[model samples]
Target: WQLFTKPLPQPQSKSQNRQGGEQIVLLGLAAMAGALILAIYASGATALYNYSYKAGLMLLSLITLALLYWSLERLVRSPWGRILKAIREDEQVAKALGKNVFWYKLQALMLGGAIAGIAGAFYAWNLTTVYPSNFEPIITFNSWTIVVLGGAGNNAGTILGAIIFWAYNSITRFVLPTEIIKDASLGAFRIMSIGLILMVLMIWRPQGILGKKEELTLGQ
Candidate 1:
């Protein structure tokens, strides 16, 4: 929908608009085909009951992480990445410089969405099931925490942030006085601790552990 509306040139006539719509449809179909292929391959591999799913999952995850990291690193170091940074800092300035801000933004959104979809697919494979309840609003918040803790716009930082967040959760689960507090209350306390830690981090270093202060727009 964003591709159809935001990035493309405004069509002056009905025929031109139809053509644009057709392009989006074609792209969507291609994406779906790729997804189908991946699904089939994963299903076949995991279907073998004797096969170790954990080993396969771990190997696949490492490969995916490497590819994603390499791709993002290369992109961010290119000239196009400078434009993206400019757009993020000031869209109006990017527009004034004759850059297609809308198109760049749309591209960023599409890239992010695609990566997220891949991650979701992997998550489903790990769980061996896909259910509506699997997705919750807290998932988004947790992602935000990781991003903020790691340092915005820094891929390595984001990865480290996620590790730290999960490590904290694991530690708390085992270290907390579960006998004193009910299981439900303990869960709430764990969440509150994370929130408190985030608040402290925000106050001390709004740019995150690895982030440069100049790169942040906190005061602005």
Candidate 2:
């Protein structure tokens, strides 16, 4: 208990350790490389194989998502990633272990903001125009729903959750309108469905599909 309470010793050689800036730079470089490959493939695939433009764009988006997921997975497995987890679990614990918790939190925010920026840029490109109306308050709730359905700390689960969510959206858009609900109440029904699903999940499996019980931090 005393040892845990005491501040941990700092490393003697700071230069030997990987810095946050270096990690960010590497992530940026990886994104750039992935973008370059995507551009080359998009052009060649469309021109040579006669793939539809929309198909090519979809392929590019999938490739970009894969690259981002891979990069993030790598980062999460690194020592610095462990520290981030520690901070998430308990900032005071991380501070006691000699980590600059505030700095790590800032880095996390920066990384998240960058990823959101990339997604926004891709969305604008896909739609060919951006509208303030596109980003409704419901969008934030939907994101939270994805996280909850997928489980926090599980990247693959998040991806799967997204796929499921879109599938649900498709059904609501096409089938529900014709078969079940009136158009006026469809939006309310959709939100209600999501809420019910969340309630069921919370009751039966709060940790989510791919989440471990130990990794569950709902109340914490």
Candidate 3:
């Protein structure tokens, strides 16, 4: 597998190359899922088994957030991280130079999935249950809004985006007159406000408040 990532002494057939790539992707996904499950179970057991559910979840969220931030920061600064950025910019060029483009992409997918899985677990824990409605398409759009508002490539920006998004909702819910706007109308107003904010951001600062102009891949 390691040898496949380096320049091959001789070119392999297309079938063989395809098979290898598929195997790598499958293996990477399995490993990522397994690790995520194991970590969640271990943390849940350690926290929930010994303490109240709310307390356990709180502890777990703090620990998870810290570790996630630290790990991602380190990973993004590593040599392999540079390769990831290069691949993102031009996968064909990376592949042409004997870099395992499939492997890199698979790694990125697995990493992203694992992080999202952890977040989902925490959210479910908070809600005390998971429902089909929780996985709605609008959730994906909201995530995109957070990412775009914070900054696409900046981790700190992402965190800031989430904070700002939620803070706005929290403030509005507290300040808005429930007598004038019923629950449904209040929800609709929040969504409308978010849409308006996003539109203004897109027009005035498409790169995001914290995102650098160079980090943007939109016009490029």
Candidate 4:
């Protein structure tokens, strides 16, 4: 969703071509870090299902998401925010104006990750069990669908997108054919429909219903 399509650091960045070697290195490091972290936590697996498990996990996720977004908002001190906006408009010009472009991008990445983390936590909560297959790329793809349907760069639009998408999702649960199709099959098709809706909107009304075109454009 917001993490995938909206751009790397917003999907429309100029130097986005990460070479093969670079990708491999990045992924390798990520895998190694993941393994190390898992090893460190291997001894604490039993507590994952204790009485306080749900509460603790939920609270941790909530706090993490809140703090992450809060830090980003703080960075948006009117002047700095404007600078970031201008950078979003044209990075070269922002740098010419003496703004720290790299730092701003880094901050944006952190903020974006925090935002995605919030979405992920909500997703995790809604699921009764955790498994590898559940977190397929499609989940993110569906989120992008929601984001695009509501409008890019518009948090309100993202919320609306979530609402509409979920509505469609729930409706299909009881409305789609049952004799010829199971609930899981309907849900899959519904997600695909959401993706299709996103593509259609991008072609017909990219700005979304309540969003400004310029503000909701690919970059800005």
Candidate 5:
């Protein structure tokens, strides 16, 4: 992990996750579902919006996408973000400083839920019509790798990480397992290969390609 300068999962805070309760998860799932529904609905609405007002549906889609970005910004920059940061540093100190820690945590979670919902809306509109089948577990894990490649705490790093991750994935998928090596379902092999890469990255260089050692600390 030190070799890469990325932050591996450390014994962070139980409250970090405790703050995100079942409600948030349920709402998030529901939002994804709703996005699927809306996408199907858009199959009809698209023509209507275009016929009735020309580009109206597409415009709405653009607005929805804008809202998604806005929501992410809000989640990252709002008061809740501060609270989460505070809690991350020292919950006891934050409470001693007279912060309504629980409320801030709750708001952080609900904001996450809403942001996911907005993302679903965009996915439904822009991507292949949203469906549960479309959301695979690999999507989540892939995101993790991207986060590592970029810089754990840096948005710019995350973007770069995404690019690097996809490129690496494509290259490995093509290069590994030549005709002689034989194919045994990329599903399992790729999983192991990626996991190995992550494990090696974690052990050797956890700070990420561009992140600083100070920025990648597990805790005090």
Candidate 6:
């Protein structure tokens, strides 16, 4: 008789993921730089630089959003997506069914990192600069808040939530009473309001406005 030992799988460390994310951001920045250089060579440097300012990145942003929304919709409806959902609901059950949960998780993390890289490129374009401070913990917290507000399982809800979040930011800047809430405290007040709203919603509608209760991972 022969005895065989199967090695236990090692879980991915957060530091590894953070390093991977940094690499993806660097790649995205490189690609954007390359495109800019090409554009400057083809068109005059002055012309290309002016175009970036006058052409308005809004059109590109909208087109990107549309394509992303369509792609995500298709992805969530696919078999692979179904497997991901299964894993999310219960990883042990997915593993029991012979599904490679680790592979699925790695794929998901890579895909998410790619998306973040693209977004980071857009952020640089919008601001015309990038710095270490730009990628802060607050950004991650805001992303989570958007996901919770929109409903985690539904992509459309996520988009809608982002729109609402930005709209609130735009409105409150002008509408908020500066007499009571000073300019310095206005931002904090808005965030607090959002938190209060989320608390109320969580107590009454934990699945979110658009998320199906059956698909809510909170129940799991």
Predicted structure with the largest TM-score when compared to the true one: 1
Q: Model 2, 96: alpha-carbon shift in Å?
A: 1.3
lDDT of each: 0.62, 0.62, 0.62, 0.51, 0.54, 0.59
> By TM-score, how accurate is candidate 6?
0.74
In candidate 2, where is summed lDDT lowest over 10 consecutive residues? 16-25
Clashes of 3: 0
TM-score per model over all chains = 0.75, 0.74, 0.73, 0.60, 0.58, 0.74
What is the overall TM-score of model 3 with all chains considered together? 0.73
Residue 155, candidate 4: Cα error in Å is 1.4
lDDT of 2 by residue, 40-71 (tens): 44445467665555455666666777787898
Worst 10 residues of 6 by lDDT: 17-26
Give the per-residue lDDT digits (tens) of candidate 3, residues 123-148.
66655678998778766666777767
List pairs with backbone clashes in candidate 1.
Answer: none
Clash count, one per candidate: 0, 0, 0, 5, 17, 0
Q: Is candidate 2 or candidate 3 better by TM-score?
A: 2
lDDT of 1 by residue, 1-220 (tens): 5654454344354332212111222222222223333443455567777345545665666677667767777877887777777665655556678877667656666776677777777777766888999778876667777767877567766666766776686667766677777777877888898899899999999878776677565113
Worst 10 residues of 5 by lDDT: 17-26
**Regions of candidate 4 where Cα sits further than 4 Å from its true position:** 1-77, 179-188, 216-220
RMSD of each: 9.9, 9.8, 8.9, 10.5, 10.4, 8.9
lDDT for model 6: 0.59
- Candidate 4 residue-wise lDDT, 13-63, digit = tens: 544421111122222222222222222233244356753444454455446
Local lDDT at 220 for model 6 = 50
lDDT of 6 at 173: 79
Model 5: residues >4 Å from true position, as ranges? 1-80, 173-184, 216-220
Query: What tens-digit string does per-residue lDDT give for candidate 5 at 65-100?
Result: 445445544655766555566665566666678775
